[model samples]
Target: MHDAATPSRSQPITAGVLTALVGFTSSFAVVLAGLTAVGASPAQAASGLLVLCVAQALGMLWMSRRHRIPLSLAWSTPGAALLAGTGVPDGGWPAAVGAFVVVGLLILLTALWPHLGDLIAMIPAPIAQAMLAGVLLSLCLAPVRAVVDDPWVIAPVILTWLALVRFAPRLAVPAAFVVALVVIVIWTAGHGGPTGDWLPRIEGTVPAFEVGALIGIALPLYVVTMASQNVPGVAVMASYGYQVPWRETMTVTGLGTVAGAFAGGHAVNLAAITAAISAGPDAGPDPKRRWIAAETAAWSYLVLAVASVALTTLAVSGPPGVVETVAGLALLGTLGASLSAAVSATEGREAAVVTFVVAASGVSVAGIGAAFWALVAGLVTAAVLRRR
Candidate 1:
C-alpha cells in the first residue's frame, strides 16, 4: 500500500469488477425513473445516463488514484427521488435542466465554503434522513399501487423481487428490473406488431433558466445531495480509515455534475452505499490497492454506460406502471435504511416525524415543494421543543 505507484501494477478482477457491477446493476432503474419523472424524453434520458456515467467514471478514477483511496462516485438517488416527487415548472423540461445547472453550481460553492458543509452537518441526522424518507415515500408506494391497479403485469415483477430479496439480497433490484423488462416485452409481443424501437437514442436539451425551478427543484436537490449523498460519502471513507480531501473531492463532484447536467443528467455525487464495497478490506489486503477497485469501476462504468442507456430506453418504453414498479423495487432497501435512520435518535424524533410527514404529503405552496417546508418545519419544531 504505497502512496506512490507505477503503471505495471496489476489490479484484481474479484474486487474491482464486482464493485462496479454491483453499483451499476443495483440502481440504474431508479436513475432512469428519476430522469423521466422530471419529464426528460427517452433520448434526453439516455444522454443524461451516459453523461453521468462517463463523468463519474473519469472524476472518480482521477480522485481515487490521486489520493490512493477508493474514492467512488455515484449519482444522487435521493435527489432523483426529490425530482420524481416534485411537479415540473411551467417552463417545461428545459426549465428542469436549467435547475440542474444551478444545483451543480451550488455544489461547487459548498465545496469552496467549508462553512456550508458545517451547516448541513449541524442538522440532526434524524431530520435529514426524515426529509429523504418523505421524498421517497411516494415512489415506495408505487409497487403497491401497481399491484392494486394491474396485478397481472405487476405481480411477476413484485414476486421476482421478493424471491431475490429473500434468497440473494444483493441481486434483488436488478432481477426485478429484468423481470419488468421481460414482462413488458412479452405483453407487447402478445398485444401487437412488435413494440416501438428498442435501441438507445441519445438527445440533448438546451437549458432555459427559470426562477421557480431554481427554488423548487435546484435548491432542494443541492441540499439533499450535499446532506444525504456527499456528506455520507465522506463519512463512509473515513469510517474505513481513509483521509478524504473533502474540498478537492467535492470540487470534482461539483464540476462533474455541471458537465453531466449539460446533457440532461441530474446530480452526481459521492457514492455512499457503494463506497463501502470498494473502500473496505475486501477490496484487497493492502488498502492502497483498493483504489484499483474504484479504477476498475471507472472502466466498467464506461462499458456499462452503453447498456445503461439501452436499459433506460427499455424502462421508459415499458408498460405504464411497470417502470415505476421496477424503480420502487430497486429503492426498497434505500427506503428501509432511510426510515430506520429517521427514527434512530430520540431527541429529534418528533421533529423528524414532522419533517417526514410534510415531505411525504407532497404539499406545494407558491411553487415550492414539501421537501423545503419539511426541513423548515422540523427545524423550527426542534428549536421550539428543546428541553420538553
Candidate 2:
C-alpha cells in the first residue's frame, strides 16, 4: 500500500552538496576534539573522522530507502564534546565500538516493540524542546566567546553575518564563512609562522578495540549520544510534521553508530537542528522530493567516509579559527530559532526554561551531562505541576 510514486532524483547533486557542506561546517571541530580526547594521534583521528562521515552517509541512505523518507544521519556533536571533555582516554575505541553495536541492537529491537516507541512518544513536547535548546546553547556561545578572545578576528565576520542574516537570510551562514576565511587568510599571510600552515594534513591509523576502553568510553558515549542527540533528533522530526516510524529511524541510527564505530567513527544519530532544513518546505512540496534529499545525503556521506582519513587530515591542518568561526556562524540561526520555539511552546515555558538552565549548567552526574538531567528535571516539573 505504499505510494507508488518514486522520489525525484533531479536534485540529488544539490542535496549531496548541501549535506556535505553542512557536515563540514558544523561537525569538524567536535569530531577533532573527540578523536584527540581519546588520545588519537593527528593521523589516527583523521582516519576515525573519515569512518564517521562514511557511517553517517550510509545510515541515511539505508533509512531513506527503507522508509521512503528523507532521514539524514550525523555524528553526535554533543557526544563528541562529552568524550573530549570527560577524556575518553587511550585504547577505548573498541569499547566504544561495542557500545555502538549494543545501542544499534537495542534500536532494532525497539522497532519490533510498539510499546517502546509509544513510551518515547509519551514524552511531552515542551520538555523535549527544552532539552534540545539547552544542549545547543553552549555551541551557540562558542562564537560569542571567540569574539572576546579575538574581536579583530571574529568581529567583522559576526557583523557581516548579522547584516546578511537580517537582509538576506539565505546567504547568511555561507557568506559569513567566506568573508571570515578571506580575512583570516589575508591576516595570516601578513603574519607568518604557524599561520603559514593553515590547512589540515593527511594521515591514517588502524583501529584497535579493547574491553577496558569500552567500559570506560562506550557506555558514557552511548548515554550522551542517545539522551542529548537522538532524543532531540527524533523530536525535531516530529516537530516538523514528519510522521515517519520512530522505531525504524531508531534502528537506522543504531546501525549507523555501530558501523561508524567499527570504521573508527564515533556515535552517529539523527540530526535534530539541521534536520529542519531538508524536512521543511525548502526541500520540495512533494514529500517524495524531500526524501530524495535524505537519500542524496546518505550517498554523499558514504563517499566522505571512504575518504575520511584524507578529509580529517586536511581539516586538522587547516586554520582552526576559520573552521570554528564558520561552524559557529552557520549554527547561529538554528540556535536562535530553537530557543524561540522552545520558549513559545504552550504550557511548557517554565519547564523549557528549567531544561535550558540545567542543560546549559554544564553539570555532570555519574558521567551523564546536563542535557540528560535537564530533560529529567523538566519532565518531573511538568508532571508535578500538571497535577496541580
Candidate 3:
C-alpha cells in the first residue's frame, strides 16, 4: 500500500511531460514563422528550433536542480510574434542574428545591473501588454484568413482546437498541431513528400549588427521577452511559493540566448503559462519534490527536439497556410490575455489603445519597426494626458 504522506514520482513526471509537450506544440509554429519571416531559409529556421530546444532544455535542468524548484523555461513567443511583424532587416538574416545576440546581452546586463531590470519594469504595463497584443494580432488572425484561403484543410484543425479547448484546455493547441500534422502528411503524400535531411542539423550564422535591426528587432525583442516571459514567470513561481533566483536565471537564459543566436534561435526565457503546469499542486503534494517536474520537463524538451527536423520539413514544404493556421490557433489564448490586460486599467486605456493601433498597423518608418514606434507613441500620449 502507498503511504499518503509520501510524494508520488509519477505525479510530477506526468506534469513535467505535459508541460514540455504543451509548451513546445503550442508555440513552435510561431518560432518557425518568426525565424522565416526575419529572413531565415527553411534550413536555418529548423536549426533555430533545434538549438532553442537544446538551450532551454539545458537551462531548465540547471535551474531546477540548482534551486530545487520547478523553474520552467520557454522560448519567447511574444518576441517571435514581434519578429513576424518586423520582417527582414537591413542586413537580412545575419543582421537578425546579431539582434538576437544583442538581446541576450541586454538580458545579461539586466542580471548584472539591477537598474536595467528596473528600467524595463518602468515601462507602463498597459503599453507593454498592448504592444504584445498588437504583435499577436495578425498571427492570431491567420485562422480566419486561412478559412478563406483553404477552408478544407483549416476546418479540421480549427475543430480539433475548439473541441480540445472545451474539454481539455491544456491539450488544445497540441491537439490542433497534431491535426495539422495529419493534414500536412496527407497533402504531402498527394504532392510528393518533402525532400530534406530527416536528421537534425544546425546551420550557423555569423552575427552582423545594423542600426535598424538593433533598434527594431533587438530592443523590442528584449522588451517583449522580459515583460511577457521573465517578469510573469517570476510572479507565477511566487504564486506557487517558490522564489526564483532572478539573477541566476537571467544569467543562464542570457548566455543560452547568445549561444543559440549563432544557430538561428531568436530568444529563450523563463516560462509563463507552462510554469503553472509544473509548479502547481497538480505536480505533487510536497513543494520540495516539485523540482523533479522541471527536470522531467527539461528531458522531455530534449525528446521533442528529436522531431524538430521532421516537423520543420513538413511545415516548410506543406501547402500554404496549413502550418500558419495551427500557429494562429495556438496564439489565440495569448492574444485574448494580452488584449484583456492592455485595457484593464482605465487611466492608461488611451495610451494603451494608441500603442495597440501603431503596433497593429504594421507600419515601419525610417527602417524602424512599429513596435519601437508604438512605445514612443504610447509614452508621448501618456505624458500629454498626464499634463492635461
Say which candidate scores most in lDDT: 3
Q: How many residue pairs clash in each candidate?
A: 0, 10, 0
Ranking by lDDT: 3, 1, 2
Please report, in order, the local distance difference test score of every candidate based on alpha carbons. Answer: 0.82, 0.63, 0.92
Name the candidate, 2 or 3, with the larger lDDT value.
3
Clashing residue pairs found in predicted model 1: none
Model 1: lowest-lDDT 10 consecutive positions: 3-12
**TM-score for candidate 3, residues paired by index:** 0.98
- lDDT (Cα, tens digit) per residue for candidate 2, span 178-279: 676566556656656221122333343344455444444554455556655677777777776776667767767666666655545677777765676666
Worst 10 residues of 3 by lDDT: 1-10
Model 3, span 150-196: residue lDDT tens: 88988999999999999999889999898888998999899988877
On TM-score, the stronger of 2 and 3 is 3
TM per candidate comes to 0.91, 0.69, 0.98
Q: What is the lDDT, from 0 to 100, of the residue 335 in candidate 1? A: 81
Ranking by TM-score: 3, 1, 2
